[model samples]
Target chain A: MATIETPKSQYGQIADLLISRIQDGTYPPGSSLPSEDKLADALKVSRVTINRAVGLLRLSGYVKVKRGSGTIVRTLPVILRDAKARYAARMQGTGAGEVEARQHNLVSNTVYRQIAEVPAPEHVAQTLDLKPGDPTLLRSRTLFANNEPTQIADSYIPAAIAKLSPELRNENAGPGGSYGRLSDIGHGPARFTEDVTVRMPTEQEQQILELEAAQPVFQIWHVAFDAKNKPVEVAKHVMPGHLWQLHYGWDE
Target chain B: MATIETPKSQYGQIADLLISRIQDGTYPPGSSLPSEDKLADALKVSRVTINRAVGLLRLSGYVKVKRGSGTIVRTLPVILRDAKARYAARMQGTGAGEVEARQHNLVSNTVYRQIAEVPAPEHVAQTLDLKPGDPTLLRSRTLFANNEPTQIADSYIPAAIAKLSPELRNENAGPGGSYGRLSDIGHGPARFTEDVTVRMPTEQEQQILELEAAQPVFQIWHVAFDAKNKPVEVAKHVMPGHLWQLHYGWDE
Candidate 1:
């Protein structure tokens, strides 16, 4: 485990040494690190120093400490967000989330759903070009990646458009999710603008997502425009930052 | 200021109301909100509740509190990452970071620079197809937006290629930055892959970026490939998440 020389700072040195080992695959992801006492003895450091080093690793998201199970190296799930593939999936009657999960060899499910006709929130109203409090169909769902809650997504569409398709009112928006149903009604998204921000999760969000105290949330606001450049659907996603990486590629 | 009816939870309700106001432009970005005492009195809540609500807002990136200044609405600088524009900027001998800053009407400056020849980290080595400890040129700089430290960019290029262009070794990286100089030497970035993740900032990062305690950092790992699909440069950017929003648009 000790491949590199220790640094000046004791605990930091230990942490760096451990991180190097982890990176070099001496300890693979989801694998447990040695016990604190064992690590302390191996590194010729105090138990307190080893504990502090482990704490640093946990804080930086290199590892996670389970209550009874010991420390395990963290493995983040990567979602390849290919713009063209995502749009093609929507056209083929599959939700982009489902497509992403499938690409990662994971099953995606909607763990929770709340479909209601409510007053549009100010931000959503602005994106949809509707006045605040205007009636809109709000579909809120918790998307799970392999049965683990991964994101909270809320989509808003004008009440008129939502009424045109019965599928839009159900949890399974037949085939491609909302976009597929919208297309059935002669309105398909032609373009998308995604705005991503990061912040600490709220108490409620932390509970719902089962996020760690130090985990921040990625707030993605996606606005889809129709062929005519009119906003058709506005969605917001709050995803636990530590569990996910958003990957995108482009040609120069 | 209280346009909506308060919910059952006092502080949460107040926070929600305040957030609505902030979203609707009642409290514009960079404008200070009323004092705690004033907010407490207006919401008919105790000062403790008002303080808690304000703290929530701060954590959620809606506001920031300075030592003497009251809570001020946060204004996230938008970086429109247009693929064509970014690639064009790089081809025309301008760094993409500079182009982004110019679009936002802000001057981009490199406030810190560390150039060295060192071993490539495991990830960078893999991306660059180099053996660990193989010579690589590391150019690390702290990029400032209008004098505010916003990002720490670290670029790793193979020492062989880096040595071909003196511009790659210097702090200023004379016009068009490393990629432009790389083009002069017949190796230009033709493709790019960007991976974005979010996490809490370390103590050292917090001080370097002057980030708030609750702020998270966006870590972006970018790998640029040349016409032959060979990875030419790998870079990592750590940006204070609360102060920046990454925007990208795509057609369906």
Candidate 2:
């Protein structure tokens, strides 16, 4: 086995080197890692240093350690979040009306579209304060990151609001998307709340995102309200779980 | 091929049946699943109904569906959450030299604990307004739901607050135990704010939680505060991604 060839306190460096090899398909997932003693001898470092480096890798979710078995390489995988502001802008600007503001970060494979349909899920109906099987417009997309499949987002708008725009039905055409369409129709979200949950990838999710067996994904539910604080839309994103690190900072 | 023999609308029920079989070692992880046609035939249902049932399983991360091949059983996993209330009450009550309040979920197998230790991570230090590498007592726990590992938590507290009780270290002697000692110490959390993210499980996490290859876990970071809104402690929990659904309802 190729050993970690570096000095102690060089844990990050060693980790990066190993991770790069794995990312580049050198040390393929499930490959056995070199023993710490062997790695230290080859790297000209003490076992303690190798241990720390491996420990960091383990903590970061890169490698697995088994007592009877040896260490094994693990793939770096996660979800892609379209909940970012850029995505919101992309959906709106691409649809209709004079695009006053341009949204950037449009990847080649990304698909954006608006579909008018009835709300199918129970949770969505409750959020929109509509009965089950209620009419709703579903604006959706399958997002990609670096040409890799990422997320499937479907946002539902009440039929009453959706009927205001006959242009919203076009697969790729709607004024400013739903957010913009809502504004164009004289309604804008004054308040929005987001609830996020992490769970194992559903089978369809695993296939659509092509995630490995161990990868999970994030399901983010975003509800937007108009000036009257009436819930207007609920956007649900089934995100791939391998590619995000969320950071939240609060002020006192 | 065992088709869903229950009510058609009961998606979760079928999923639970399959999950229990897998969990109890009836069909170990990575085992092939019966074909939709076969299952439907066995259960005297249409393939459409079987597909819907299977779809639910796939969505919840219970099974994998391959185009050329067939469906495969998935692993039902657990989450790891560190409860901080146990420690919060102990630390605060001890500081006031008063009896502490202890809280536990009504469900059996739910548990809590707290301890004192130096915080180490930069994020925790920044949140607590402490210098890097400062001494802080760390209290944490492994939460269980019905004797199954739900989450593993790690919490950090400033040493100044921890020194209020001298016998804190000895309390952690037993593995997977913490709440009782916290009562003796008398500290409690008055408030808590949580920041959560969902993603794929790292290799280290997979092993710790005994997770299967396809399962992901959620990461929740919570910061507790005292009655005066002073920062008390920061806790991190790793929860199994597939089994959790977080709910947040806000009224306008």
Candidate 3:
């Protein structure tokens, strides 16, 4: 049998080897890799080559350098959010996120950081079908999973509806969350759309989510529409990539 | 009205201001930003402050320093893949990705890079409910959007099924592509689960997608199930984050 190397560069080959080790559990998640010098010595490669390989591994989300910890492998998330089950739960006028958190054996809490009627941002105004500078109820929340901040979601609602419902401006929304309160106010959401993207966390997002270096975030723009097809609410959620993955299932 | 500054650091505040300019269309997508010195002079800040602010902006996906283009605002994606629509299209024996590219006035193309029977990886084997090292037919393709590499998708099919279907081994899978061929072979897909996560691209992925610096990739593991709920096919798609976003719609 003949073994032929492909078009990969020398550093690329080294990175692939390191990745296989991680995948095969040699360098399990949350475990630190050996020092670059050790790896270079073992692989008979220069320090520069090992450095490039580690850089690739870092970018590939296999390992990240922590403040106090060395190059630790990324941890696998335990909390898995299924879009289908969450839809069913939310449709029943329940706190779907909290329910899922509980199912994962994690305590879920929503900390209302800010609840105020303010002029909407330009994009938010357009999304909510309001003129720029029109007043909107902004609910800022820090969602905690297992007592740690997991997500920062800022929800925007039309000022009229929010003003009508008192909980929309308070710390607790009583029975269900904000969605439940909205249903009681004749604006029950019938359909939802979640547009998901990814980017490196901003400075503020890093502070809020307590994300580490090289961690990206899932930037989800979620919109809820009433039965009349009118946009009822718009929320932007920023969650750490290491802690989250979005799953969607559909029957063919 | 009196104004009290928030707890944001100096560079953070500057990044926010610059973000506002980008949002307001002052620094439109794909447009190069002013020099660091010029921006510092205009914003009345030191060059170091501007550099830090720009660093934040770069991470946040507002802008990136292209090799020759300098700091250019990230371009908005013209192609939007609605998961629901794609699900329906695939269910009906069609290539949803190609349909979407056509809708966006872009030329969609699939370049088959490799097609062979290989031992399934441990993860792929587990996902497909097969024993480790079992033979699987691998179909590696590079999907092009508007004649540019947009995704590198590697699909794995059980050896038994692939060998039975002749077209599966060929670049041209007759009408409707591989999914259609699978349906014709009585192993039709009945349902699908797409698990999506984001990470920085590997060296190979970066080269294949022709991605710029600091660009992330969406790694989606799509599993197709038969009517009996048995996993039939497993595919791992690596798409440039800037070029794609997954949207899901549901009734709630």
Candidate 4:
């Protein structure tokens, strides 16, 4: 293994110490960090040095700088997205999302955006086995937690499958979301695969998400396959990376 | 859904156009982008504008600025860590990691680091259902892809299990990694859970991984559970986020 390097600089060393405190609950989340003056006096360092150390913490999403208030430790994510358990729950006709919301004391909701038939992009076409520029059905929505915008999903379905399920063109796809509509058409989803990649958010995404400084966004391509091993729905979800953590579990 | 904002600045517009081209494979991975002068002339914008446009791409990790080769699109991650499939394959006595290494035409290896039995940290103790500062076995290793330092894993085993399996003291825990030795004492893992969070790397982590600018690191807390639903092992993996993509699939 590569040898772990010890921190050299005073500020980096201070930051590491503070991080350990955060991990150990010495400084709990949702609590304000002591002022730079207090910290510097406590650590016997200059206020400027303390400020830089706190800046590093902010950059790492450990803390946030609130206007008119002190630096505060950001709260841990209220929801944990566990894919395997979530799918299993959904398959059984209930789900984990609302249960988590209740557990976290947050409400969940979604807002829809209307979009007309659109041409499939290159990647989407390849995934859905269609030619680029082929017409497809699109469902656009912004999911919220406690009325705060969280994830934006854009689901695309092939023309044939869309025709088979006319509800795909509506604002609501009835109960199980679009999966229920597909099931009605005898193309129920049997399996799902998701690919996740990270990137600095575009200006539009930042504005939409009201993202914090140095926070990144993840683009997840989620493909749903039917029992016959045929891909049916291709959805792309954009989420703020800092506010979310993905969990995966497998039964051996 | 939130309305998408149009790029206001000329440079931002150019960046969006270039990003679209990259997505469409007009500028493929490992390919050089057009020089500032040529792009300025082609788009009728100043060289300064073109430079700023390319800078956005660099920050977003779409491309990297080579010393004299101009900007080059970064190649995609060769390994797709499909969690469900990988776990099943491992249980069946084969795995996806090596198969992906062969397919990507790369070599994979591990470098073991010696770590003495240390007190379980607060989080590890909580996950393993032990008291804080409880003695535990440690396995530290850095996984390499094509000889490049990719991921660092620190696995902690509870004392009882460690005593049950003598090999836990050694660097190599025999065949199926630690899980195999685990099976020897009838404590084979029956389930696994992983929780991931993202943050900027510490100075030492950045040095160890040789991370690029604007890249983030992911901390994954993985736990293995026995058939009786008892937690036995807790491992932490630190990985460069941008160079890796995690895939999760589930059956209904």
TM-score for each of the candidates? 0.77, 0.56, 0.80, 0.81
Query: lDDT tens digits, residues B76-136, model 1?
Result: 5655656457667877878777888898898887754578888999999988999987889
**Which stretches in model 3 have alpha-carbon errors above 4 Å?**
A1-78, A90-95, A212-214, B1-78, B87-95, B212-214
RMSD of 4: 4.4
Candidate 2, residue A252: lDDT: 21
Q: State fnat for each of the candidate structures.
A: 0.67, 0.24, 0.61, 0.71
- The DockQ-derived docking category for candidate 2 is incorrect
Instruction: Give the candidates in order of TM-score, highest first.
Output: 4, 3, 1, 2
What lDDT does candidate 3 reach at residue A158? 94
DockQ winner: 4
Model 3 clash pairs are: none
Best-to-worst order by lDDT is 3, 1, 4, 2
lDDT per residue for candidate 3 within A40-145, as digits (tens), equals 9999999999998898777666776787889998664446778667756765656766867877677788777778888999989999999999999988888887
Q: Per-residue lDDT tens digits of candidate 4, residues A70-138?
A: 888877553677766665665455534555455577787767875557899899898988999988888
Q: Return the TM-score for chain B, candidate 1.
A: 0.85
Better of 1 and 3 by DockQ: 3
lDDT of 1 by residue, A134-249 (tens): 99998888878777677888889999788999778887787777888888888899888888888766666766776654567889898999999989999998987776787667
Per-prediction DockQ comes to 0.39, 0.13, 0.42, 0.51
Model 3's CAPRI class?
acceptable
